[model samples]
Target: MTRAAELPGAASLVLASGVVHLDPAPAVFAAMLDGWAMQQRTRFLKASTIQSRTDLVRRFAAYTNEYPWQWRPVEVEAFIDHLRSGQRPIVVSTARGYQNTLRLFMEYVTDVRYAWPRECEEKFGRAPVQILHEWNTVAHVAEYEGDPRRRPLTYDEVQALFDAADGRVEEIRARRRKGALAAMRDAVLLKTVYAYGLRRREAWGLDLTDLRHNPKARQYGRCGAFYVRWGKSSKGSPPKRRTVLTVPEMDWIVPVLEQWLDEIRPGFGPGRLPALWVTERQSRLSRRSVNEAFEAARDAAGLPEELDLHCLRHSYVTHLIEFDYPERFVQDQVGHEYASTTALYTGVSDEYRNRLLQRSLDRHADRWSVS
Candidate 1:
C-alpha cells in the first residue's frame, strides 16, 4: 500500500521509539501517537484511555482495509455517509474520531518529513482533500437536536443502577479475588465514578494519588493540563482540564482504597497510587474494563440494555440540573470544554421540557390541579 504512494519518490517511513522519519518526505520527522503511546509518557491517565484510541484506530483500519490516502476521497465520504445513516449518533462521533486520528497521523508525518508528497500532489492539483458530505447546514443543526426520548433517569433510577452495579462488583470481587480485599475496594470504586459522573475514559484515567484527600495530591480535574505530558500535541485530546472534587463523602471510600493501596497496587504507599483502577489480574485497568464493569452492573441491576456507561454520567449531571445546581458547577464537574457542550447535558434532558410544559395552560389548571 505504501509503495503506491512512494512511486512519486516516497521514502521509508521509519518509527523507532516514536521518532518517525518518512523518507523523501524529510519534513515528516514527528512521531504519531495514539492513546497507547501517550500512556507510556504519563501515569496520569489510566491504561484504558490509550486502549480506547488504539481500539478506535484499529476499528478504522479493519473497516477501511487500507491507509487513508489509499482510498479515494469518495470512498472516505461514503463511509462517513453510511455511518450517519444510522439512528445512533454516537456511532457518528466514533467515526469522526478517525478524522482526528488521521489528522494526528498527517501532523506527525508532516513534521518528520518537513513536507510530504501528498502536499506536493495537492499543490499540483493531483490530489484533493475530501469534503464532508453527510450533513447539510439545516440538517446538521437538526442532527444534534436533542433526542426527545433521552431525558435523564430519575433519582430512584440512578440509585437503583448503582445498587445494581454494587451487586455485580461484589460478585466479581468474590469470584475473582486476584487479591486480598478487592470486593470492599471495588464497591467504592464503582460509586466514586458513577455518583460523581465520570466518562469511561475519566473513570479509568484516575491514579490513586488523584483520589487522595490532600493538597499535594494531583487533581483529577487538571490531569489533562496539569500533567503537561498528558496534554495535547502528543495525546490529541481536548487541551483543557475538568473539575475534580474535595468531597467529604470521599472520606467514605478512603479506607477501602487505602487497603487496596497498601496491599494490591504496584507502587503502593503514602501519596502513591500509580493508577486508580486495576484488573483482577492486578494490571492497569483499561477503558474497556470500566465499560465491561458498568455493563455487568447495569445488566445485573436489570436496567434497560440501552443504559450505556455514559448514561450514568448523563444521569448524574441531569440530576444536578433538575435539582438546580449551578450551570458552571455542572460543567466543571462533567468536564465539558465548551458551554455549548455543557448546554447539551444541562438543557437537552426531557425533564426540563416536561417541566416547562407543565406550566403552560390555564384552562386545565383547575381540572388537573388537586387545589
Candidate 2:
C-alpha cells in the first residue's frame, strides 16, 4: 500500500494516515477540497478562483445532501435546475460557468494523478466520478452569450449618459450634499472607462504612474496612453498587461483626465496614495463603487436597466468601428487576443451599417449599371 506522501495527487496529503474523524464522509470531502486547492495552488491559480470552486463543490454537496463520492449526473442536473427555478435565476452564461466550475472540480478529484478515487473507494463504499457531461451542461452555442439588451449605447445615448453623470455632480452640489466630490470623480471615471475601453477591474486598478506620454501625440502629453496592468488574465496566469493608446476621436478625454489629476483628484487629499481614483477616505476607489456610480448615471439618463457600465466598452468598440478604425487596431486597443472577441463587443448602429452598404454599392456602380 502506497503511503499518502507517495500518492501522485495532493488529495492524499490532506488525509493523514490513521486520523479518523467523527464524520468520515464530511472529513473525506474536505480532504478532497483541500487537496484540490493545494494542487491548484501549485499551478499558480488565483486564490479567489480556488475558493469559488471549493465553495461551489460545497454548495452542490449540500444541495444534493451527499458527499463527492455520492454525486451523480442527476444531482448535477437537479442542482442546476434548482438554480434556474429560483426567483432570481442565473443567466445562461452564468449557469454554464457554474457547470464548468463544478466539472473542473470533479475532474481534479477523479483524476488518477490525484488518487482521489482510489482513496475514496477504500474509505467509502463508492468513489467520485465526473458528473457533468457535455449533454447535461449548457452548450456554448453562441459567440456572444450575454443579454441582448446589454449592448452598445448609441452616440446620443452615450452623450446622455455623460450629461447625466455631469448633472449628478451639479445636483449634489446644488443640494449641498456631501458626495459632490465623489460624483465628479465618478463622472470622469466613466468617461475614462469609455475612452480606454477598459473592463471594470482594469479601470479601478489604474495607478497615477500608469499614464504614459505618446511621442507621436505630444499634444496630449502624459495622457496619450494607459498602461493597463490589471487586464483580464488567462486561467492560472497573472494579470495581462497592455498599452491602450488614446485615439484621436477620444481626445476630449485628454483634457478630462488632465483636469481630474491636477484639479479634482487633489481635493480628495489622498496624500501618498498611488491610485488614479481616490475616495473621500483617501483610499483607492473600489470596483463596487465604480458600478454604483455607473448605475446612478444610467438611471439618471433613463437608460434601460439592462444597460450597465460594460455598455460603455461596447460603445467604444462600436464607435471605433464606425470611425473606420481597423478591426485589428480596435482589438489591440482593448487588449483582446482575437478580433472575433472584439466583434462580439461591437454593436454598430443601423446607420453605420447602411453607410457601409452604400460604400460597397458605390464601389460596384459600374457593374450594377444596366447595359
Candidate 3:
C-alpha cells in the first residue's frame, strides 16, 4: 500500500480542503501537528513522547513567529544560539535532542507520502524543508556526556549516606513524629536501589511478585534477584526487561529487603497492594518520592550536592569492579548494553587500582629480580 493510503484519517489532508477559515495559517499548522501525532501513534510510540515532540514544534514556531512552511535554516541556527547564550543554558546533549526532534518533524512534513509539502506549497507558495543539517547540529562525539562531577561515591561515603538514612528514621521516632514508617521505608528503598543497580523507574516499579529465587543461591531464597520490568526503553519501544541478580558482596540487602517485606512494610497497611515500596495511602511509591528520600539522606550525610540517587547505581558498578567481578558480569548486572557504558560508570578507587598494580608486580617479580 502507498504510505499515504496506510495513514489514519487524522493524518490525511481530506479535512484541510473543506476548511474556510480567516487565518488558514494557524489552522493548517494545527492540522499538521495533529497529523504528525497520528502518524506517531500508528507506530505505537508512547503518548508522552508524541506530546513532547509536538510541544517542541509549537515552541519553535512561536520563537520564529513563522509556520513550519516559512521556517528557514537561519531561524534554527538563531534559536539554538539564543538557547546557548541564556543565563540557564541547556547542555549540549539537550540541544542535540531538540535539534533531532525538529529534524524529525521536518522530515515527516516534507516526505512525499505525508503530502504536507504539497499542501503547504499550494497554500503558502512554499514547502517546509529540513533545516537542521549536520553542520548546524551538535554531533554525538562521546559515548558518555554526563557531568564529570557526578562520579561514584566511595565506600565510606556510601556507608555515611546509609547511616544518615537510618539516623533520620531514629530522629523521627525520638521526636514522636508521624513519618517514622515513611522514613524507614525510604532507608530500605535506597539500599535496594544500590543493591540491584536499578534505575529510578525500575526500583519504583517493583512488586512483590518481581522477587525471584535463584536455584543456585538457595541461601538468599526468594530475595536472590529481581525482574526489572521498566528498564529504560529505546526509541519507539516498550521498556526493556532484565533480571538483576544479587551478588554475594551486596547480599546484605537480602535481610534488609526481608525486613521491609515482612515487618516494616506492613505498617503502611498496604493490604492487597503488591508493590515492594508502598506509601501510607497504600499506593505504590512514586519516583519523585524516591528522589526526595535520597536528597534528604544525602543532605543529612553531608555528602557533596552533586551526588544524586543515580550515584548509588554508580557506586554499585564501581564496588562490583573493586570486588573483582568480571566486566561482562557487571555489565549484565546493571542492564548495560555495552561494556564501554559500564566502564563510564566505573571510577575505581585508587586503593583498588594500587592493589591491581601490586598483584601484577608480584606476578612479574622473578623477571626483574637480579636477572
Task: Give all candidates' CA lDDT scores.
Answer: 0.51, 0.90, 0.91
Candidate 1 C-alpha lDDT tens digits along 259-324? 555564433332333666765555667767677766666677787777666776677677667766
Q: What local lDDT score does residue 338 receive in model 2, on the 0 to 100 scale?
A: 86
What would the TM-scores of all predictions be?
A: 0.55, 0.95, 0.96
The lDDT of model 2 is 0.90
Locate the minimum summed-lDDT window of 10 residues in model 2.
1-10
Summarize candidate 2's per-residue lDDT along 1-371 as a digit string, tens digits. Answer: 55656653466578878787887888888888888888788888899998998898888888889888888899999888899986899889999999998998898888777778888888896788999988899999888877898999999999999999999999988998799889999999999999889999999999999999999999999999999999999988899999999999999999999999999999999999999999999999999999999999999999999998889999999999999999999999999998889989988889999999999999999997998
lDDT per residue, candidate 3, 120-223, as tens digits? 88888999888989999999998888888999999899999999999999999899989999999999999999989999999999999999999989999999
What TM-score does structure 3 among the candidates reach? 0.96
Which segments of model 3 are wrong by more than 4 Å? 1-3, 8-16
True lDDT of residue 320, candidate 3? 96
Q: Once superposed on the true structure, which residue ranges of model 1 sit more than 4 Å away at CA?
A: 1-139, 142-151, 169-184, 212-239, 246-273, 279-281, 347-371
Query: Model 3 lDDT vs. the true structure?
Result: 0.91
Question: Which residue pairs overlap in candidate 2's backbone?
Answer: 9-114
Candidate 1 is scored at a TM of 0.55
